[model samples]
Target: MDSRSLPNSSKSSKSSRAEVSVKRSPVEPRVSTLLDVISISMGETG
Candidate 1:
């Protein structure tokens, strides 16, 4: 589902806030993607 489907969003400020708004997850970010996990581990190892 798109973030626009959620509350508090209006089309007017979307161009500026879209990135920040879409990043707000109601749940914790998952480690579902292998690439994501790998990058995280690599960062930790640095």
Candidate 2:
């Protein structure tokens, strides 16, 4: 029981970590693009 539970907990933790990373990546690109565009516009104006 202990052995099985240990592996299961590890798998769940890894999956949760992967899911969080996947969720974060989509938002990062959008925020990054917005910052890039704003910088470019400021550069042109300045």
Candidate 3:
């Protein structure tokens, strides 16, 4: 029981971590681009 539970827990944790990273991967670039655009616009206006 302990051995089975150990692998299961590890697999779940790894999958959850991978999912979080994958979700953030695309979002981070979008947010960075938005910030860059905002900064550029402000610079031009200023």
Candidate 4:
């Protein structure tokens, strides 16, 4: 993992306050990739 891994992971799973409208952004592609990695990490740990 690198420096970005932390912030991006946190941002994606942080809260539902802005979650709805947040998906309309163009950055969703990259963010989704990061979320995938986070999901794998969570699965492995659990």
CA lDDT, every prediction?
0.66, 0.97, 0.97, 0.82
Model 1 lDDT, residue 11, Cα? 60
Q: Please, what are the lDDT tens digits per residue for candidate 2 over residues 1-35?
A: 68889999999999999999999999999999999
Q: How far out, in Å, is residue 34 in model 3?
A: 0.3
Give the per-residue Cα lDDT of candidate 4 at 35.
99
Q: Judging by TM-score against the true structure, name the best candidate.
A: 3
C-alpha RMSD of candidate 2: 2.6
| Of candidates 2 and 1, the better by lDDT | 2
- RMSD, one per candidate, in order: 11.0, 2.6, 2.4, 16.3
lDDT of 1 at 36: 84
- TM-score of model number 4: 0.42
lDDT of 4 by residue, 1-46 (tens): 6998998888877765477557657688889999999999999999
Across 1-46, the per-residue lDDT of candidate 3 in tens digits comes to 6898999999999999999999999999999999999999999999
